[model samples]
Target: MQDYSEKVQVIHNEKFGRHLVAQLDIEAGDTLVEERPLLVAPHWECGQMKCAKCLQESYVMCRSCKMFPLCMDCQGHDDFECQFFASGGPGGYICKDLLVKNYGVCALMKFLLLLEDPSTRKDCERLLETPINLDDYRDGDGMWQEHEELAVRPLMASGLLMSLTQAQSLTADDLHAYCIRIDSYSFEVTARDGDTLKGVFVCGSLPHHCVPNTVVALDEEFNLKLYAAVDLKSGEVIYNSYTNPLMGTSQRQHQLRLTRRLECSCSRCLDPTECGTNMSSVKCRECPDGYALCELSSGGDWRCSKCSAILPAADVHELLAELGGALVEAKGELQAFESLLAQYKTLLHPNHFLMLDIKQNIASILRATALMNCMDQPSKKLLARRVELCSELLPICRAVVPGISKLYAIALFEYLLSLIELVELQFSEGELNKKEYATHLKTGRLVAKEAMDLLRFEPENSSEGYLVERLAMELERIESDIAKYGR
Candidate 1:
């Protein structure tokens, strides 16, 4: 096994399989692990044409295969899969349209090719594999059938995979097991252009947490880096969230169950209020002041905190679905979002996941409008509302996402911008004197600095890293304005 990090040690257990534990006290922002992927390929749902070798957007097709897309640079590098495609395997070459739609075939081909090396095969065998029942697919049986047609059958029919399987004493079942392992362990890496790549890392797959103590980032070249999101003591387990942190407890649990096939009993998962953020709570319809909280389980019933009213699990689920559908239909429209928020304010907890979603959309719309330099009364009110929304979100983000995270950093950055704009507007209309303006500028500088600190660990080429660069320029501008006002 690769020694990916000296600060952490891999530990195995009956429950977690393989997990990482800290060896020494680690501070927030500390680099925990860094490793290049053992295997990298286009994500299963990747529809955009990309060079099979470099994963960059490309229209240039390989002359040899005439089916696989390759960049001009990669055309000269003919590998095993490339040659097999050119040879038109036992069942003939897979059509380009089929390859494009089922990108997992390409990814699976890479995995099969890697297994040709005995050492690599042995290394991969050590990774965890979850059992997959094609009949029990969450999407439906059709998805599994489609996978069989688009990904599995094509690869099995390939002459390269067949020869390798026979030579290596591998069977079709082993191929299916390898596919299961890839599905279970592969990390989705966002490329520079925002497309995703699936990467299987050896040590990187070990850590697991619902509210992760570690943040993972990938650079332009897809090199993975793990950083401590919070301080950790020696012997403490390192955790990385497999799902989005912003999701509510039930939503997170459902996603984990669907993807990883396990129920999380993590601290955050067990908390009905989700660490006191009330992200999953709703207002009790039967009581004036009560909010209903529930267990994280899908079938858990909700109980009112204030009035002790009981709400059936079915009812709660139906309400959530209705609100979710409405929110989705609202899309990006400011008026629709405001209307939805108004309609739900009395029925949902202020920090409910759906409520937050609506607020976030409202804030985004207002921010875009503010950026257009609108200074009318209604526009100013909307900008103020945006600032208020960010303020509400930042505290919740701090409670849920905690120390250095992209969500918290983004909320803080947006809050900082809104505050600066609102303050500037107030000062320009003579709502504040020079001293107050300077003070507000200094405050804005602090907020900008905090945002920078949080985003420091982001990859230099990623979107969050771009925010850091923009924040630096904004900081300089803030300082300049502050000096001018002070003079």
Candidate 2:
């Protein structure tokens, strides 16, 4: 409903194909762009029983097609799709069982339907196509076999091609190209009910950075809104991170390369200390109290900041691989994570990404235990540990992901919740006077307000958005308690 397109412009260069730049000076939190997705499809991993229309798990099937799943409320919504599925020629009816097993076929069908519209087809043509390497699939390690069986064979057997080709010509190669384009450019959006869906957007395909200057959010209908994460001067390029911000430099680079065919040399990626957070750092074996920082560039050796001891890049990679394997084997077990934390405490930096990951898992476990409403000794200990882990993570989150970040917001929320619980426990145990109780509640109110500001833009149906309402209620309760304490 609001237009911010005039505030930003798309530009092209030899280095980066297409990127957005600020047309005017923009303040932090300013809306820079808004657009709806050109195409939306269920994620490949969607469960078999999810309704084709609402994407909710349902046992009801479309009575007309008797193939596609649909709840009673969603029955009429699939009229056109149902007709096509039912009208396929002899032996052409797409088996409901097969469609359930191969969820990707439904997405391909949606793409083909969109291609039938001239304007939509033109938009799809403008998207960048990812080149397919046949050799990668030759050994059955790639998605080629899966695509052939699930997508190509099913479409060929259906009447979708006949209906779609009536207006314009299409070939098997064209379908393959469309698949690659979708894979390269689509965003994984969480739907209103938490189902994952892939969406391709025109303006959203542009900007790429390791440390993004913009944050993107999607509402219930998958309408995207991009906000400036930091203040930007006129003509400055607007960038968005394509990978997880919490990942180590090497992990982010590898994910970017694999997903987007990008080799990121962004400021964050180039800095060995990663803006002084040292998330990728390890302990220096040669010197006491020294840590080795990653050399992000190829074939560069890590050097100790205090002792100047050298560690080969290859050895660092090998060590990381071994640790990563062990972490996978831990499988979210509390004892396993404790073992990892104790074993790696002497080998890795205190804030190393791997160590942080294990701590996050531990915090999650402790948070769950603390929220169980038990005021026993073990519960209090778990609450204390949760508070401690969140305290350690908050500063690193601030250092690495400075402005309005989801990671920072969630950590802050967890920390504040733990702090509030501890305060209440202390008050109930007579550990604090009435004035102390009111003072702690006042502090919690401020923290809850901060968390509210960070989560303001989350979609109403999302888990984070739900937290906004919870924080508001929390603030009200804190205010009441503070008043009762006469502070």
Candidate 3:
């Protein structure tokens, strides 16, 4: 018998290059791998104070280098100080002038500092050897060149680099290669306390797919956890959706092309109907009952399945663009968005991104009501109606976003919360019998359990990430209610 317990193995091809394939039958929610990051430092965008040791947001600043913060747990540790001083910049006292430039510059500086260690430098050199196509870097995009000069080159020239024998003779070209590697492989790692940092997982081998079968999230320890989102057969290739799975095929392809410099040829990308969900399809102007699907080939026209009438790509583009503008206009306005959802329902498929977008907006509105202090009868009714809308969205979400994605977890959480809210509203109004209340409470518990399981690894900073605590409370409350009812 074949040994399928190896978990995953690396496979290479001319088309997809190096990617991970499952070596065993894996069920959804099963942990595939846990990888410790090679390097972790603050992102250029976040200026928040975090522990230099673990990246936790709650911390005390280092006495010498005021810029570097350390948690109480890491403080007074001789080893930590020795490592910091060896890093060079954390050697002397830091002033405001140096502190202001501590954003992306420090991350790069840390990379240079790590190179001073023989073991870490060897791993970094291995990372630099990873193949990257030059075409991914656009000449028109000055950001890459700017980062290379401001962050990369400066770090290469710093005393930190000169102190390391391995990195001492590093050239600008070598620095440019490191920059590319960082841009390509770095994952945004967020700590349990909401502190965020960017790091590269040198040991991971997962590759991108338009519709991913796996979900990756950071654990409390900042190690990357990979889970099988769907049941994986032995020898199947594992794929991670690099872009948002909620996005339509055209949008996903466009994003991958711009960012990864490659058009996806995944089954979903090749299918115009997007695996029969009709997510990218729109109402055909030529026929009432028929929907138009874009031709699979590029520059191909959208044609109605019923009437055989074709619409040019330009016309379809203009229509979607108009709907996109309307979506933006209705952003925070509930009534306007409700009307837009109805209007788009007539013009697009139920599973279209625009329709889903409005549904999500409505769900957000309902989810927020769970936190409301008071709810009158009318407010409760509105909440109930929106809850129904959220229920309708679940099947589509499950079909496309099968994994433990934020969207899937959020929808499940919102639906469960709405159920709990409705039960409470009814109980307060003397409308729910013990039997009826118990039923809803039981359903809420099950849904909450599933959602919590799905979002177990979600970062604490995300909108729905904090729901785990609330969900736990709701489930506990529901179980008590069920016990009181003798269920």
Candidate 4:
């Protein structure tokens, strides 16, 4: 295996399914993981019909069974007969097409064919030892649609035919064919317990579990980390978290049943309980009664556990979205995504479904800036949307929006200004005592400090680093005045 410690890495472990354990221990605000995508699959092609031979569902047309495609490599496979074409043609597995199309036939198949001949399987095996950026065939677009699967027969026949009264000698075309027919498989290796190095375990190697102890969450490094969500004994199996942490019982149960194929009978799923609902409203004495429990609630939203009263817009969705970005980009698409510029042009429009999505977004961008798209000088509508959304997304907005983006920076400024104004009014109205006024001013100072955090130094003066600094100093001055006059 390739040693990647030079790039990025962290300690991780796996254990047998003897006793169950929690995935990881996390503080209320501690970050558990971070990851970067080695390869990504496009979202649009994931669910599409894929060629069984190659796994490509896009671009390349399968040759023999023209219906299912191998893109280009296997496009030549048609010279020979094969299944997976289409109805009334050849037919095979649909999903494998994308995988086959891009990577070509399995690397192992090619390696074996090379060894069989005086060709080189050693070279192939050497390549296999390292991590290669290969697209997945399981999802349609995961693999590039343009590559052709490799083949092998010709190379083996090459030397034999040359000695005889062969009309033709083995050529590049024949060897290429041999390369495509090779079959390959995938496996993963990790320490069985915290410290023992076991070999690799193949796919579906372990039996399925409803709720296993070892929780698998991807750390920021994009590698899966097995955590002890709860403590475990020496002999235990590690499991991964299957759904969102804050998701309610019914939703969680439904997800497990639908995706993991297990009926979750966990205590939380069985109990008609609501989590975090009444916690918000009960704080302000808004809802005296505790929030109602639901075997199946629509969603937790802002409903507090202490009080069922709806919490005024806290922009929790935005908070979750920002946090979720780390994971979403890490696992990648299982298929790669379309080019960003192309995707925006294709998917986003005023009356399109995404517009509906934009409208339906529970996370108000008005409260926070976008993490990815909020950079650069966007179109009018996008800019307006940022202004509308990040106006409310005070703390997280700067993190999401680009410092150089005019609207995003302006939004931060306005957000800070509004806060400063709100607290300044506290002094004007005498509703706030001297201490209260000072505290409010301090908050304004913090907001200004956040603006500086948003500033980034680029090759040259990237953006408004000093401007934010000036604003922070201004907030400090306001705090000083509040200290003197209010007393």
Q: Which structure among the candidates has the greatest lDDT?
A: 1
Error of 3 at 335 (Å): 2.2
Candidate 1 vs candidate 2: which has greater lDDT? 1
Report every candidate's CA lDDT. 0.77, 0.75, 0.71, 0.35
| Residue 208 lDDT, candidate 1, scale 0-100 | 61
Native-referenced Cα lDDT, model 3: 0.71
**What digit string (tens of lDDT, one per residue) describes model 2 on residues 1-487?**
3345788887887665666789999888888878777767775545555676766666777777766777777745444556655665224534556566666677777666655555466665556332455443334434555566667666776545665553236566566555656766678776656767787776776557778888787776777888887889999998877888778898998887666557898889898888788899999999989999865453678989899888988888888888899999999788899899999999888889999999999988877766576779778777878888888998888777767777778777888888888888888989888999899888888888888888776667656678888888988988899889944
Question: On a 0 to 100 scale, what is the lDDT of residue 452 in model 3?
Answer: 87
Residues 1-487, candidate 1, lDDT per residue (tens digit)?
Answer: 3445688887877667677889989999888888777777775555677786778788777888666688877744336556656666424524545455555577667776666545577656566343355434535444345455555666666544545653346555555556657766778877655777787886777546778888888777777888899999999988778887778987888888777666788999889989899999988988898999994464688989898788888998898999989988986999999999999999889999889889988998898898788688787788789889999998888898888878888888899899888888988999889999999899889989998998988888877788999999989989999999966
For residue 296, model 2's alpha carbon misses the true position, in angstroms, by: 4.2
Clashes of 4: 86
Q: Total clashing residue pairs per candidate?
A: 0, 0, 0, 86
Query: Which stretches of candidate 2 lie above 4 Å from their native place?
Result: 1-4, 47-49, 59-68, 78-101, 128-149, 157-159, 166-173, 296-298, 459-462
Candidate 2: Cα lDDT at 5: 72
> Candidate 3 at residue 294, lDDT?
90
TM-score of each: 0.88, 0.88, 0.85, 0.31
